[model samples]
Every structure is written in C-alpha cells, then in structure tokens.
Target chain A: MIDKILSKYPFPESVKLEIKEELEKLNLSADKIKALVDRCYKAYTQNLMEPEEAAGIVAAQSIGEPGTQMTMRTFHYAGVAELNVTLGLPRLIEILDARKTPSTPMMTIKLLPEYAKDREKAKEIANKIEATYLKDIAEIEADIKNMKIIIKPDRKMMDVKELKMDVLKKKIEKSLKVDVFEEDEKLIIQVEPSYKKLIDIFEKLKDLVVAGIKEIRRVIIRKEGDEYVLYTEGSNLKKVIKVPGVDFTRTLTNDVWEIYEVLGIEAARNAIIKEALETLEEQGLEVDPRHIMLVADVMTVDGELRQIGRHGVAGEKQSILARAAFEMTVNNLLEAAIKGEIDYLRGITENIIVGQPIKLGTGDIEVTYKFGGKR
Target chain B: MKVRLQDHILVPKHEILSKDKAEELLKLLGITREQLPKIKTSDPIVKEIGAKPGDIVKITRKSLTAGESLFYRLVVD
Candidate 1:
C-alpha cells in the first residue's frame, strides 16, 4: 500500500522512503499523505544541487575548518591500561589515508544473546578471542646450575583465564619441543642440558601464545547495561566474526582496509565515514557527516580504498597539471614530459593554475545561447 | 550458521539490473557502461550476488542526508 502511494509521487526513491515511514505512523488518509508528500517533494527539489555547482570545494571547506580544532591525542582507557585507541586529528588523518592497518587497531565485539547475558559465557568468549601468552599467566625461572626451566603457573591467574594445567603443558611441549611434566604441582620444562638451551627455552616460553586467538593481544570484557561487551586491543575481523557466540553483524573493527578485504568496498566506505565521524565527535566538534561521506565516497567509488594524497586520488588525476601541482612537482612534470603526456586542463586546480576559469558554474556552460544575440 | 557479506548492515541491498534497465540508466546518465564506477567480479558482494562481468549492480546505500541513495556499479574483471 505504501509502495503504491509512493510510486505516484515521482520523487527520488530516497525521498519516498522517508515520507512513507512518516505516513505509516500517522495513519493518514490518501489525500493527507499526498499533500504531505507534495510539500516534501518541494523541499527536496529546493535542496538539490544546481547544475555545474562545485560541491567538492564546499565539502572541503566544511570539513577542513573544523578539522583545525581537533586535538592530537590517543584516548587511553582508564580501566584497561593495555588498550589505547587513536583518536582526534591523527585518527582522522589515518582514516582518510586509508591505512592498511590502523596504528592501534581494535574491535568492539558484541556477543550473541546467550553469551552476552551471562558473565561466565562472556568471559569464556573473551578467553577464546584474546591471545594469552605464557608470560601472562606464568613465571619462568631458569635454574642455571641445573640447566632446567621451571614454569610456575599462577593458580589464581590460571583460574581467571580458565586455562587448565594440561592445556598449558601441551601448548608448551608442542611449541618449545621440550619435555614438560608435572612436578610438585608446577609444570617443569626439561630443556637440553646445555646452558644456552636453558636460557633459550626460558626466553621462547615467555612469548609463546598458549591460548586464544593469536592476533588479539588483549580482550577486556566490560559490563555495559545488563550485558557484557568485549573490547580487543588488536583486530582480526576475519577470525573474530567466525567464533561461536559472537554477534558477527554487530562486531566492528576500526581498520577500514580489513573491512574492504573481508566485507567488500561498500562496507569499507561505511567504515571510513563511521571512523572519521567518531574521531571528530570524540573531539567535541560537530561537523556535518555529509562532508565526511563525500570524502568516503570519492575514496571508495572505484571499489578500492584510496588515500586522498598524491599516492592515490590526487596523483591519479586525468589532467597532468593537477597531478604535478599536488606533490612531487618536479618528478611528475619531468615524467610527463618524458612520456609526452597531455594536460587536458579539465580539473579546477589545473584550470586555476593556467589562469582560466575552472569548469564550474558559468565556466561549465560552454554553449549557452546569447539572449537576443547581443553583441 | 554460514554468514553472508550481503547481510551485513554496511553492505546495503545489491541487485543486478536487467539489460533494458541498464541501457536506460546509461542513456539517462549520458554515459557509457564503461564510465560507470566499477566493482570487481571478485568482490565478495559481487560473488555473493553471482553478478558476472558486464552486469550492472544497483546498490541501495542508507544515507545520512537522504534517507537512502541508489548507486550503480559495473562488474569488471
């Protein structure tokens, strides 16, 4: 019924959808809906861009002006000392740069209903997701005279991490290729009788990943409302989303490139907008998200996440002059000369450099009829 | 349970346009099919939707300003 009413409006599908939702709640009659839609159509058309308008310049100014106010800092988590998220201007730059891996890549993982509601289940998921090193749960002491490395598991930390002695022993034996056996309620690793081997085993054992997902260094489970949510220090979206009890749809990583690799370009575009908006919002600056979206669209329009700099968008401009003007001026000009490259002078920057009116507004109208054929 | 990339919130809805509709879109935009933004045939979404090369996929993106916006991408090798 809504589609039928909206089909006749002739407005863009976007406009029709919004109006349809508003109409659904009011339970309005057909005539009332038509009158309301007519008003909305008028507003939408009025908001539409004029032909040859320079939206790019407007978007740049909107975002750039507020970008000047952002602070340079990484937000530190007071409760979880190990986690520090890149925020403010640095983060904004990182997002626009389309960095392959964010400086401090992290994920906010939401669990399924069964896991989220129970603290124990949430902890189990966290243990399964976080990488647990031997150093995290045990102390390794090399008895120099005896040429043996003693692995003493802290029972309390073991209990908290839910790591059993047998599991720890097996992981140690497999990685270190040493004999690990129970000794006086402690796990003892017997290395070669050589002094060098004992020291080597001790060092290797400290860094060994005994449990959980290897990429995620830490997973902090925090109570948000009635449910528990996990915040991870390192991000591995491809693996985390597959883990049982994880609400994959809701799991999000700060790294946009990972999203592109796993979910495709559209998700990466959304990630770019989301990450940028979050960085800006964190700094208490409320620039319009549309400005960020414009940037995101350009970066991902080619189905590849590209940085806005010389190495990506600006460097790939059709006009040689625009590319040369952006950066590596001498090199770009030299290369273009060597290649006999032509400058179409199509873009705003290049046209401005040549002292010609840019291809925007009146300059864009090359063949407008002269009124009354005036001289 | 298996997960589909299309089911993600950020993915939006993707549908392969009919040949006639694709030509109509090209004519309306006054651009050739090659001029449309390209999505790789290997793209996870393209693979999921089973769009072949030369197919035009319509993407319905949920927007902040507009309630939703329609985008078209040419599937390319």
Candidate 2:
C-alpha cells in the first residue's frame, strides 16, 4: 500500500518515507493516504522561501512604510496621571532603536491558580509588591529655627499598611543614623545645631523607602476573565517572579531588558517581536509576523540586544565602508584607516557604493568560462 | 545572579552537530561560518549544548501558525 502511493506521487525521497511511516501508524486506507500526501505537497511548496530573494529589503519596507503613518504621541493610562506607556511612532522607534529602558515600564502579574480567583488575595499581593516611600505616607516639614525635620505620619495610611509607630521610628533612626523622638503624634528628627546643612538632611528623609518592594511603584488589581490580574506601573521581573503566589509561567513584563536579565536573550527576542508587533498594530498597520521576527533575530543575533542605527548593529558592521555609509562617515573612515582595516567588499552597502553589483540575488552567482569547450 | 537560559519558554530545542555532520552541513550548504546565520557562543542554548565556536547548531521550534520548523545557526564569538 505504501509502495503504491510512493510510485503514484512525485514526492521527494524523504516525503515518501514520511508518508510510509505515517501510514503504518494509522489505520488509513489508500484513498486517505493519497489525500494526505497531496495536502502535504501543497503546504510544503507554499511555505518554501525562494533562494536569492531580497528578504531584508522587503521586511524593511513592510515595517518602515507604515511607520510614517503612526501618530506621534505617548498614550497615558486612562484616568491615571504620570503613568504613560510610550506607544505608536515613539514606541516603534524605541523598539527598533533598541532602547535599554522604556519610558514607562510595566508588568502584568498573574497569580497562582489558588490565589488567582480571589480578589482579596490579589489585593494582598498588590500591597506586598507596591512600593511606598516615606514622603508618600508622611508630611515632612523642615523647621530652620529648631534645626529639625518634622515627620507627621499619616495614621490612616500607616494603619492600612499595617505599620507600627515604633517600627517606623526605629527604621528612621537606623536609616538616617540620627536620634528620632515623638512629640504628641509628630516624629521629630533632630539635626545637630552645629550641622551646617540642615536642608540636606530634610531632603534625604523625604526619599527613604518606608515599605513594600523597591522597584514596583504601583500595583492595581483588576479582574480579567476568571482571574484577578495585577497591573503594575513599574517592572521588576526578577524580583516579582520570585513572589510565592505569582504564577511565574504567565507573568510578563513590558520591559525587554528586564526580560533579558531574568530569562536570557531568547525571551528578550520574543519580547522584541511582541512589542514591535503591538506598536504597529496599535496604529492600525497590518504586517507579517515574520518581518518582526527577522528584526528581532537581527537585533539579538549576537546574544545581546542592539539598536538598528549607529552605536549598535550598524556601527559595528565588519565592513568599514558599510559602517561609513550608515553614519559618522568621516569618523568611521578615519578609524578604519588608523586600524589599517581591510574592506572585503562582500556586503550589500559596500558593493553598492563602489558601483558593483550587490552580493545578493543574481550577483551571488558566478559563471566561470572553460578554457576549451566541446564546440 | 545566575540565569537559567534553558528554562525560558522562548528557547527552542537545540542540538550540537558532531564533527563529520558539521563538516557535511557546511559543504552541503556551500557556506562558511561568516555567511551562515550566527548564534553567539555565549547564547544559553549554545552553552547548554556545549557547542564551540565554528560549530553548527540545529534549532527546532514549534510554531502555532507554521507547525514545527528547523533552523541552523553557526556559533560565533
């Protein structure tokens, strides 16, 4: 039965063997095998990428042309102040430029199965992750006459955070390396009268962390589908994933660099693809994922993320002429000269500049003439 | 801090080719290490597979839209 199908179709040897192996495993008749073989042949031929095709140029145009239409604006979180995610053209530029830190980093935290379904548990997790500073929960006033910094703790905020006054006083005493005393409800941090700079001490007291995770600025618990998801304003993927209740498998961050640091370059590559695709789609542009994949692959090909322009992939091109053509032409040329570098003229840009056919497509082929042919 | 690169969901299945197989692959593709798609020697999969510079590594990935696909990269510095 396998021999009959093999002889009937002009499939490759590998394809024929695959069909034979598959047929032996399944209880399929001759008719079904024929249909399966036909379908496989169609799919294989449809997916083949032609050799010598200028794929890079096509990908560039596919992404770059629509890039012009993207609106130049950062999207503010709805009804939230100072929480803006860079989107549209600016974000697209950032992704391609391979910016180390995004303008507004964020994370979407998914809880473990047991905690995911409960709102109260999710809120508890949010409180544990959200960072709170001393200034956020206290009014610190500077008194020049007494040479003291007055810290008036918000009792309601302290109670909500489950913080004790004694702990707060001890924390301040230890962090500032100074004596702190309570008068009524106010905690007074006394600066030495001989201390010349009383204002410096007051500024330092305002920025101290009072509670919660350091990197996570805000965490909002919002129910999505069947689970309560925590949307955070800042990203701390490495630390956040270690939280006991976090579903590390599904927890994701918008910062590519954070992903790289926590999960390595492979995750960073995937993040680049996702971020680039979202940026384009947000502006109503339709592009093949393969193009984005190519870009991501190029950016992380060296096991590190690199921008498309100078100071990254382009600047580090092996070909001196290629680097010169990109930007800082005179600087590149001078450096290459000093280094006594050799330009092999192998790449597309260098070849084109010198009026030679690019080493791509038809130019990649070489036709050598025989000394004496059978004429 | 040590990062577990192999545990990443995005990392594909990777295998190092033996000397003969690597030579055959290069001859069949008619390309040098510089011409082939590059994978850094420091890449996690390359480190996991114990592949050296100039060695060929085969990567297999399962894509939802494209099903299973195979790719090759030459390990480089």
DockQ of each: 0.63, 0.30
Error of 1 at A307 (Å): 0.8
In model 2 chain A, where is the ten-residue run with the lowest total lDDT? A76-85
TM-score for each candidate, following the candidate numbering: 0.87, 0.81
Q: Show model 2 residue runs off by greater than 4 Å.
A: A1-28, A35-43, A76-83, A181-186, A194-196, A368-375, B1-65, B70-77
Error of 2 at A281 (Å): 1.4
**Top model by TM-score, which number?**
1
Please name the candidate that would achieve the greatest DockQ relative to the true structure. Answer: 1
lDDT tens readout by residue for model 2, A1-375? 768766876565556667678878997887888788788878877766778888988899999899888887777443233456778888888888877778878888889889999888888788778888899889999888888889999999998787888889998888888899999889997888845667777878888877777888888778788999988888888788777788777788888887776665666777888888887877789889888888888887776778888988788889999999889899999999999999999899999999998878888989999988988
Native A-B contact fraction in model 2: 0.23
The chain B TM-scores of all candidates, as shown, are 0.95, 0.76
Candidate 2 has a TM-score of 0.81
> Which parts of model 1 have CA positions greater than 4 angstroms off?
A1-5, A12-14, A17-39, A76-83, A145-147, A164-166, A176-198, A368-375
